[model samples]
Target chain A: MKKKVLTKEDILHLAKLSNLKLSDEEIEKYLKQLEETVEYVKNLDELKTDKVSPTSQTTNLTDVYFADGETNERGLKLKEKYFIVKRIM
Target chain B: MNLHGKSLLELKQLVIEKKISEKELNQYFLKRIRKFNPKLNAFITVLENNQLGIPYGAKDMFCTKGIRTTAASKVLDNFVPPYESTVTKKLQEAGMSVLGKTNMDAWAHGASTETSDYGVSKNPWDNKRYPGGSSGGSAAAISAYLVPAAIGTDTGGSIRHPSAWCGVIGLKPTYGRVSRYGVIAMGSSWDCPGPMTLNVEDNAYLLKQIAGKDKYDATSSSIAVQDYTNEIKKNKKFKIGIAESYFAGIDDQIKKHVYKSIDVLKKLGHAVKPIKLLPPKYSISVYTILQRAEVSSNLGRYDGIRYGNDRNFFGQEAKRRIMLGTYTLSYGYYDAFYKNAQKVRSIIIENFKSVFKDVDLIVGPNTPVTALNIGEFEKYPFYGELMDQLNEPASTAGIPDLSIPVGLDSNNLPIGFQIMGNYFEEANILNLAYQFEKETDFFGVIKKGINNYKD
Candidate 1:
């Protein structure tokens, strides 16, 4: 398996996608750490998984249902049955 | 009025007989917490006025209604949950009071609680050493008798790792055996909320109270919960598998203690057979990729729009995990990383399924080594994953496993022996652990840990 070399730009892009603002030090640190982590995980490539199906969850159950209902109580800060959030626009 | 070294069941018995009032018991633990918390840093939030029932520490991951629940991160430092988690609710209903919300790694991201935004939790045995983590504080608190027991969620090795290091019994029940509702998410597919206690009986007692299905958590199992307390008493011989792969690279002292434990099991008339298991190193990669991916997704909820501080409050470790997750799940890399990891996770699960056909349970050392120095985590980039290599296979396979103190190492740090069972087989895991506890009394490891903080 060819190892992916993680560069500073890749780290910054990932940080952006992850909604994190990394300091210059953090970027440099993650660049090295993330590279090492990525390299380590590539060992999975050694296994032949061609015939196996991915297990997104272990429960082996699908389409589990619950009675549809709504309670007035919620953990979020709410106003008039709507969550209050900072305006993005 | 010395309550030191008393198990949860013993304390309950005392309360029932009116030997000690519940109020006095709560106060006893409260005073201990106040006295030792400054030095140990085990708890993030201590409830001084909690006078409801028998007090136990809850890993800060569980949401307690009207009480602050932080996953040891600054982001949720002020986030008091409006509703209670199912596990805590069940424990509360079973007459357990929340003494405090214990500290953990930030978002349960690291094995060492040094990643905690609040502070690192020290090992009760040696303050210079780390109590193995994400559930480090819970394990530390239980070990030091700050609390009789605690509930900790294990994603990869969060509960068992710390329990091993702190010389306490920690069970990571089968995935979905306990509801995930109201617990802070980390590796959603692998997360299992379980008990950390000073004895196997208390661990079974707590698991009986907390294990079962919940409507709110879709992944929770529909299988009937077993009467684990009674189940532990039944005399049964198990076919235990000794996997050489699990012992590979384990410390020499740890190997000696674990093998001694296996010999004890053999003496108990249980058959021990050598079995081949897939090298645990493969599960490490599967766990790292899949867990990081799940973490990135689970943490997406913390936009600061509804609860917790903004993404800016994420710790360095959390950021690093999120970035790697994003990189893997990003365009063009999903197939090479995320999807492939899932396929390998399937292989690991199948591997355990096949091994269980020949054995009732698999036993081995819990961690590769004993408790490490506080600052040793910085030496490795993926220190938690490496430390948790043996534990990840069970986590990935969604099986039940327990960690019990076998003996102390040369440094006086605790060595842990693990017994892993088939899916939803917590009863079997607890039974073997209970039998071992009766035979060896865990070599007085738990007693020594509590005596370290004797009043």
Candidate 2:
């Protein structure tokens, strides 16, 4: 497998997808480091994993429950609810 | 007399025995922090409110209601959480007083606290060198005797690396063995909250307090939490394995000192033998893919809304990792990179399972070398990741790994004797570490005080 080199455009697209804006210098830094990182990770391709099962997490739990929402003293319903972000106009 | 050299477990006992009030204990640690923190840069925040008990420092990443939880990032610098983390809450419930928040790698991304937006946490031993991190500040606090113990979260050697460098005890409990509830997420599956302390007994006692299931975190283990304190006191002997591969890339002095510690274990009635183990380098690749993927996804929630500043608030290390993660988990590359890494993760876990079948625990060096001087990242961009090479496999496998002082290198930097046990085998590892600690005097040697820090 040919190791993929991450181009500046690739990183720019990644930054966009990741919701991050990068400066020209940051882009240059990522270009070199990310390219090297990708190359290093290419070693995974060497192992034959066609029949292997992926271990995304070791916990093996499913259907995690969250508490029911209730209105706090502030008159807003709360319970696992994150702070509301300002809407982008 | 100053309480700086005492173990937290010992201090807690004194508090219970009425030898000292919790308020007095708090004052002793608070005074030490005030004196040493300017030199060590170990603390991010020092709380004024005091409670009577064993004072424990928390890594800034763990959310504490009304107190700042920065995760050492500029994004969350002003953010004060409305709730406490489950682990810290348990500590509070168990009578451990919160001293303050310690420094860490920004978002716990890098191994060194140098990545923290606040300031680099200095090594307590040698001010010129790094304290080894993401949990560097926690380890440094314990090393400097600012606090007897501190809570640290480890994903890829965050707790263990700094423990090794700072010359203290670092225990990375089995994944899910401790709750992640209210912890600022970095890698969801891999992040584990553990203890860094001056002695093994304190590490065990602290683990006992925090290890249990939590309704808030579904990933937390439902397994029965062991009486780790009592477990450590039990006399036990078993087979110990030392893998040649774990020592391959480390410095000669570290390798030599670790072997000397292994010999101490042998003298204590445990059989030590060389065992064939999987190449840990493979874990570097898997950890790189999964951690980066998770980092990108986890940090996605930071949009200057509910908590921190916008995406623009990330540091270079965080952005670098985020970009790489986004690229790897991107549409076309998902199967080849992200999926393949997970598949390989199973192989790494299987490798540990096979090894654990023969040995009660595996022993090795915690890092490739002792803590390097600052500016290491400039010379080698991957210094943190590469330094963590030996310890990452056990982490990726979700097993418990403990690092204790083996000996010091030629430069006087500490070498760590790493003992990795099977999943849910934290007590086994702690027992061996405790036995080793009882037999050795390395802990006292380190506490003699660094020559450079003027008292």
lDDT of 1 by residue, B1-114 (tens): 678888899999999999999999999999999999999999999998988799999999999999999899999978999899999989889988999999999999888899
RMSD of 2: 3.4
Residue B92, candidate 2: Cα error in Å is 0.8
What's model 2's TM-score? 0.94
Candidate 2 ranges with C-alpha deviation above 4 Å: A1-4, A62-89, B381-383, B449-455
lDDT of each: 0.91, 0.86
Instruction: Name the lDDT of candidate 2.
Output: 0.86
DockQ of each: 0.66, 0.56
Give the per-prediction TM-score of chain B.
0.99, 0.97
Docking class of 2: medium
